[model samples]
Target: MEQEEALDWTIRTRDPDFRDWDAFTRWLEAAPGHAAAYDALMLADADLPALVPAEPLFAGTPANDRGAPASRWRWRWIGGGAIAAALVAALSIGMTNRADIYTVDTRPGEVRVIALDDGTRIEINGGSRLRLDHNDPRFAALDSGEASFTVTHDASDPFRVTVGDTVFEDAGTIFNIVRAGDATRIGVAEGEVIYNPDSDAISLPAGRALREDGRGLTIVSVAPESVASWRQGRLAYDNAPLADVTGDIARSLGIRIVGAPPLRFTGTILLDRDPQRFFARAAPLLGVTARHTRDGWILKERDGPQS
Candidate 1:
């Protein structure tokens, strides 16, 4: 029974995405013999001499294959117990990813795309934080920032994204989500999404958008084609609050923008990595003069602001 359990753990940890570190640590620490047993199986897989097993449990047979070098295997066999303990300590130290959680983050200017095991793809914008489970593909949590999800629909197992206390579940959807400060914005480019399906349910269909903040929930209209447009370096807006527009440019372009949206905007702003180049074009469309300051860019009302 002990050998079988140890064999199971050895095989599981070998998986590239295996991240249930805490449980594995507990199992090893629960019994004194667990670490020795687990390491023995690991050694056998590498065709090295096992510390506890009388013979290599599953060593391969190859005529020309001399086993892994003796110096390396000898060190591992002698130090397996200590090494196992050290691994537990190391995996337990990090607070970012606890238990089965695996975090994916991007730098301010970085964009990343994560492909999950079950054919779901998530494209996270710059300055985004997303979390996924090592075992569950349908679950995701957004700690902060923006992400675009293109989920493969499974009626039996709907894909769910949790933002703060709110939950959004996909129903054959392609959606974009942004969480900034105390505000969350959701837009569905295709299909539908259920907001808290179990209670106070709200359905967001294609071309629909929702924003929630300390104020309350507000539903709005969005252009279906313009959703997740940041992926294509274009931001499309129709009667969008200037605050939302400015927030997006700052987030996607990776710059600090300080301003209050006293007015509404309706236009498209092309993305440019260079701040100077970007504002030169965006300011005209936004009807604001972009001034570079020591801290960041400040958007002041342009003389004769565009109507």
Candidate 2:
């Protein structure tokens, strides 16, 4: 039970948006060997060093980015059988090294550009997981996170990106994709993306965006330049869900934004790189009041002034 809980905490704390440090510290203090067990498990894995992408670009770093006192190795556990979800909490030993594949995992609030052998440039957002093949060069998979791709298209082979079951085939253009939780979003700015060309293919051209969630796929019109605007220190939205907006804020700012209003937002917000400065202007626009907490900021619906 202790090891299971330790493993669970290990995975949770590594999450880009993880908070609850006090609670985690309490758990660490609960038993003397608890921290030891956690440390031992993490040290054993020693997550491979992330290779620096050529021609990297820097972005703002989030403040108060605290977590467990451990190394920066991420682990992904995959157990065979029906109850694989449960195994995630019980074990943290599924990281694999393949000769053909490599992964680039970004830190929260970090933005950088990486190049492929084919000269395709990808600007990856913070807290993202992207896998690339050193051998194939054309096969890329975004396990989770967000990235903008400027593909070096090939008519014969084409560049492919796998997200969940869907594959985005580049059709000679620039586009951005994001997979947050179960929801996936893609937008085209200068080129086109074939949403699964094999069967039920959807042509996604410039000035358009698509979002897939539990309710299904929703296609909407977006300003072409606004696509992946985060690359330029801004976030643009059009009737976007409150949860998604806040989630994006948390990811971009690298702090745990703890609540979402039951509302959708339509506007653009500048990423000022400073939490307080950003909220001072953004809270009014979002119609929320940001209250500071030990864990992070809590966004509450504006309900008049306090007594």
Candidate 3:
């Protein structure tokens, strides 16, 4: 059959029961050259459908047999076909891979705000990566780490977020989900979110916090400012654990809290200033000592003078 006919057959054979499956398979495995030609065309068709359909297939088949000797011409055509196929396939593979990859990345100690095409806004936390498929209307997969999402309401189609094994249904709400250990910790700042606690619906209102603990949803009233403070350059804590407070400071200030543990603080500190001074001032009150490190701060128990 003509090369154009073969290509057309391949294009039309997207159906499984197209009866030409066997023929296509035969063509695919015919020879290294034949296989290469088929793969090149197939990859091009899959990768650049618009371009492939616009270009003519099998364009330069000689009209007369009087040109070169039959055997030499046939071998030359085979070599040409192989080269053409390899080039197309290579280009197609590269383009397809590049286009298909979705990367949500953040630098260490840097929170990045990204706006999605679908009107959803995402704030990726420092030292985190979230892979998302915006094209999938039913779901956006947060493949790793933590992010806060301000989902644009679309009732007809649910905007679902998948973090680890737990899936969150955006009830047209603004919420922050952090993947910690094996659980998905969630704090809702606006609207309402339905938590699937053991495959059941449990509603959490605004200013509420909960976590999927593998057992069920543990709900509690949370301090909204503390949860949303990362959006700003400040760390707000309301009677939070010393360890937890230090962790938050570490994430925001790009420092390490190494000391006699953390002293509980329930106030806000402007991070634009030296974080070391903040730690130094607070350490005595919390019975800890603040020491500046190369990239961050470390805390240890205070030994002597109180200043």
In terms of TM-score, the best-performing candidate is 1
What order do you get sorting by TM-score, best first?
1, 2, 3
Tens-place lDDT per residue, model 3, 1-307, is 4343334443445333344444554554454334333434454554534433322234565544333233333443344465436445554564455433245545456676766667888888765667655355345666545688888888887677777777778777888877645666778888777765348677877888876656866777877655666777666655544665565566556555563364455566556446657766666655576777774577766667745
Model 1 residue 38 distance off true place after TM-score fit, in angstroms: 22
**lDDT (CA) per prediction:** 0.78, 0.75, 0.60
**lDDT over C-alpha atoms for residue 162 of model 3:** 75
**Candidate 1 lDDT by residue in tens digits, 1-307:** 5654564576456544465666776787577557656654443454322223433333654445435343333433344555444434333343223355666666676787877888999999878888887679999999998999999999999999999999999999999999999999999999999998989689999999999999999999999989999999999988888998888888898899988548778878899999999999888788888889998999987776365
Clashing pairs in 3: 258-299, 259-299, 259-300
Maximum-lDDT candidate: 1
Candidate 2 lDDT by residue in tens digits, 81-198: 2222444322344323224455666677877677777989998988898887657878889988899999998989899999999899998979999999999999999878999899
Looking at model 3, report the run of 10 residues with the lowest lDDT sum: 48-57
Q: TM-score of each candidate? A: 0.70, 0.69, 0.59
lDDT of 3 at 269: 56
